[model samples]
Target chain A: MRTIAFAVALALAAGLPAAAFAQDEGPSTAEVDAVIEAAFPGLDEEWAARLAPDETMEQCNASANVPSDAVFEEIRARAAGTIVYPDDGVLVGSWENGEKLAQSGYGMRFSDYPPRRENGGNCYACHQLTPQEVSYGTLGPSLMGYGKLRDYSEEAVKAAYEKVYNPHMAFPCSMMPRFGTNGVLTIDQIKDIVALLMDPASPVNR
Target chain B: MQKLMTRKISTVALAGALAAGLALAAAAPPAGAQTDEETQRGLERFRQMLREDPWANPALLDADRGELLWTTAAGPKNATLEDCDLGLGPGVVDGAFAQLPRYFEDAGRVMDVETRILWCMQELQGVDVAAYVKRPHPSGGQPVKDVGAIATWVANRSEGEPFAPVLDDAAGRATVAMGEALFNRRSGPFDFSCATCHSASGQRIRLQELPHLSQPEEAQVAIAEWPAYRVSSTHVMTMQHRMYDCYWQMRMPQLEMGSEASVALIAYLVDKAAGGEIAAPGIKR
Candidate 1:
């Protein structure tokens, strides 16, 4: 309790003085380097490298999550580089299974080590995918009538797939997890999630 | 952290014990021989079971947290919040929660519990409530601690209390009207409204039942409960948080936390659930 109190006091002290905490010629790359390096101390070599802000994260962080169009394009291009299209050109999967994938919010936690349970897209966590879902979190836009509005066009289906694959490809610094790139969900799972958003028969449309 | 852990352990144990007890009490055979009194007792036991595991009974937990958060205090004032009136007299946390979104003459404006808490935090503790809302929880990557706790504590106080928001007052009525409009106004990539899930009864997305918030019983259950403990997120989320989150899911800009829209929504829901019992400090799955 005392330690927490002390930390809070220190935070208050550092935070209360506006001028002291104000930006001074912006954060130096070294400062950014230090913060990023310290953030991942014990991870494996590959994971540790991920701690280093890619060009996208760096620009996003530098601009405080608001990037100019050029910067946004750059981030999108870099993120787009990570995309690996499926061997079969088809992006849409079984909407029935897709609905299940979108609804289930399991996997990705450290406890799911050895990857026992399959990863779920958990799309409903941040969006109201279906009007009837009561358990969803409200972070992203509701996906109800997604197919109805878009006419389930091939372009829209492709866009949804890309958005789910790496949200930064669509909107830079998007809070949505890069389900495909992060290995959190498989390509097939991404297809299912896409189907959930675009399938006419899916509850998302109903 | 130890204290938090201990509290969690005890709460889980208490819930387990209560669930086992209720199961035993409610386990009478489904037979024609059972008397009315026995049946009533069995039903009471089942309700108790529902109470112990509130997440299973979503309505109970929401109001339960609201009641609990009503009394606890954690501003720089270092004082218990028992005296901060909710339209009603000091420490009167009963029907006050339900009747709120009503005009408070002292505050001279209509406010719901979340906004009300923001008011108290500002007035009593000198905390910059707005700043707190703008920044994510002070402990990033960790659970939000104080604000949610305070919110839940206050909410828990009026569990079983009836909802009676003062709709006659100009401001109160205006808030309700605005909330009603917002409930149906859909503006997102998908363009969904609250009506999509809760406007009708008997709607189930999958396994979960979407309660009709328009009905008094359903409304009462929802408005009276909240600031619920969500098992998936493992965070005790406040109603304001819930509302903003809902907006996010709708793919809309986050509601300015504790803004008019948020409070008005609360008023509308609470008004809908006028006569239901208040239950606070609800546990959820």
Candidate 2:
């Protein structure tokens, strides 16, 4: 008794239709590791290492990114522990450099391998920072006048840095990737991005 | 700074629009006195309209070709795939697509639709496994591989069945687990995993709507509609090809066809799409 016809169906779903998704049980890490080795034939050592998950990722997969409150807290706390602050106390960098970082959508993709220019933060992919760009994405809250909204407070700038570093530190299971944690951008690059968000003269605060 | 950025942005947009307009004028004659943007918008709308009417889609022809390939004898042995087993039974194709990436004792591993076809090619038709493994995928207007045709036809047979694979088994569950891990694993220079693009809802790269595959409902819709014919590519693309294309766009090394990694990824998607109705040979932009 199938209801809700599928979109352009070829035939059916899987063989059985108990219709209950397997939520309680999932594949074990060992099971996953063996499969990874097989699926990606001749994988490089670096790529193979990435396939293995840390505590947060394992827990996230187990829960399908919807963990219990206790599990959520554990994931967030573990993620926060991984964050490393910059050696220099100064939180902001040249907004000019920051603006360029924001504009760029390069770095980390396989095509950029062997290292071209410095890695760009690719901030505009998700956030609207300046009114001048009509084609900005809306996945993140608009940062138009971000500094003006916060009155350029030191704490606000630091908070911005933390958000960019690892969003899970503040909000668990966030869709945003851990750019700083993942080494997509360096500490200096992150500080410049913060400047883009906090500088009074930056187009973001225009 | 704000004024300068705005001026620069507007100038860039205007310049791009002018170039596009010139290109379109050279490429196609306007039906009326419509601007290039308006004509482009109309073409986009027509693509959407064709999606609503299956008769308008050119993909159905490929699906038809796939059906003929299934029964027709192919390869060195000149044997019809009637003897090939899809784990349903020998030559039993009905509802087979929905229960794929399962462990087969003969193959000694898990196999998806594409991999199983490769198995049959070697076992039944006596073709050299190296040939298909060495062959590269063809793009636009090129004759698609036999596997693509066969996958489309097989998927077509199970169109109405709800997806519910047996993950309770040892090898099957392990493969699914590997799939889940790979889906979340971030590699390449961009630091992206599939989750970066699909974990969240209401996300898009440019104009394309990215379905969040982690959510069960979304997973059901997204996974089922794959192995589709794309208007953009002008060729029928299978689920494996879709995965291959994604990795390519991610700037990662190409995923080998019928490889363990590819099969594991399919197993993971099938498990996620459990209880979802089958939808294949779908039309896509």
Give the RMSD in angstroms, all C-alphas superposed, for model 1. Answer: 15.4
Q: Candidate 1: where is the Cα deviation over 4 Å?
A: A1-206, B1-12, B15-83, B135-144
Find the 10 residues in a row with the least total lDDT in model 1 chain B. Answer: B135-144
lDDT of 1 by residue, A68-160 (tens): 988988888987988877898898888889878876766644334567778787777567777666556555676789988999999999889
What is the per-residue lDDT of model 1 for residues B133-230, given as tens digits with 9 covering 90 to 100?
77433222244345565556556656666656676766776667556655654333332467656766665443345678888877766655576655
List where candidate 2 sits over 4 angstroms from the true fold. Answer: A1-24, A54-100, A111-118, A132-142, A165-175, A186-188, B1-44, B53-55, B64-82, B98-105, B134-144, B160-207, B214-216, B245-254, B271-277
lDDT of 2 at B267: 86
Expressed as tens digits, the lDDT of each residue in A100-187 for candidate 2 is 9887877655456788888787677778788765555666677889988999998898888888888777877666667788787888
Locate the minimum summed-lDDT window of 10 residues in model 2 chain B.
B3-12
Candidate 1: what lDDT?
0.64
Report, for all candidates in order, the number of backbone clashes. 44, 21
- lDDT tens digits, residues B1-285, model 2? 474355345545644654675587578765556543465476577566656654444445555666677778878789888888988899899998888868999988988988998889889988787677665466776645778877877887788788867665878876776677678865444445787788788875533568888788888988887677676676778888888878865546667889888888888888888999987767676
Is model 1 an incorrect, acceptable, medium or high docking prediction? incorrect
